[model samples]
Target: MPFVDIRLAGNATREQKAAIVADVTRSLVERLGKPPAAVQVVISEVSTENYGAGGQLVADRAPVPKMGEDANAAVTSR
Candidate 1:
């Protein structure tokens, strides 16, 4: 059996999670010769407020944008 544990510091839609699980299971089946039913995948979504890096909480590091602000602009500018 192959166990895959994934932790994300944010949320994902149901469809997204399902896709991830399917992809992970397929990978295990193909690479490790594990049966699909024997592969286990656990997805955990941790709150940004509870997840930290670089001595700061993720929520604090990536604050929500104010109204009318383009969120992608910051990433593009960087």
Candidate 2:
């Protein structure tokens, strides 16, 4: 039996959560040799403001000046 717990920032759509569960189950079954029915997975969503990174709360992360531009640059540079 395998139990997996995921804690992430809250606010996900129904389809998004379903895909997460499905992918996790598939990984456990294929990679760990666990039966689909034998693996247990739980997801706990918390407020982004409650989490912190780089000594600053998630809410404190400076908002990007332009949406998608920085993300595109990062992807292309890599």
- Highest-TM-score candidate: 1
State the weakest 10-residue window (summed lDDT) of model 2: 59-68
Please give each candidate's TM-score: 0.80, 0.74
Error of 2 at 17 (Å): 0.9
Clashing pairs in 2: none
lDDT of 1 at 23: 99
- Tens-place lDDT per residue, model 2, 34-71, is 98999888888888799888898877665534464775
Model 2's C-alpha root-mean-square deviation from the true structure amounts to 5.4
Q: State the lDDT of candidate 1 residue by residue for 1-76, as single tens digits.
A: 7889999888999999999999999998999899999999999999999989999989877455658989987566
Off by over 4 Å in 2: 63-78
Q: Evaluate model 1: give its TM-score.
A: 0.80
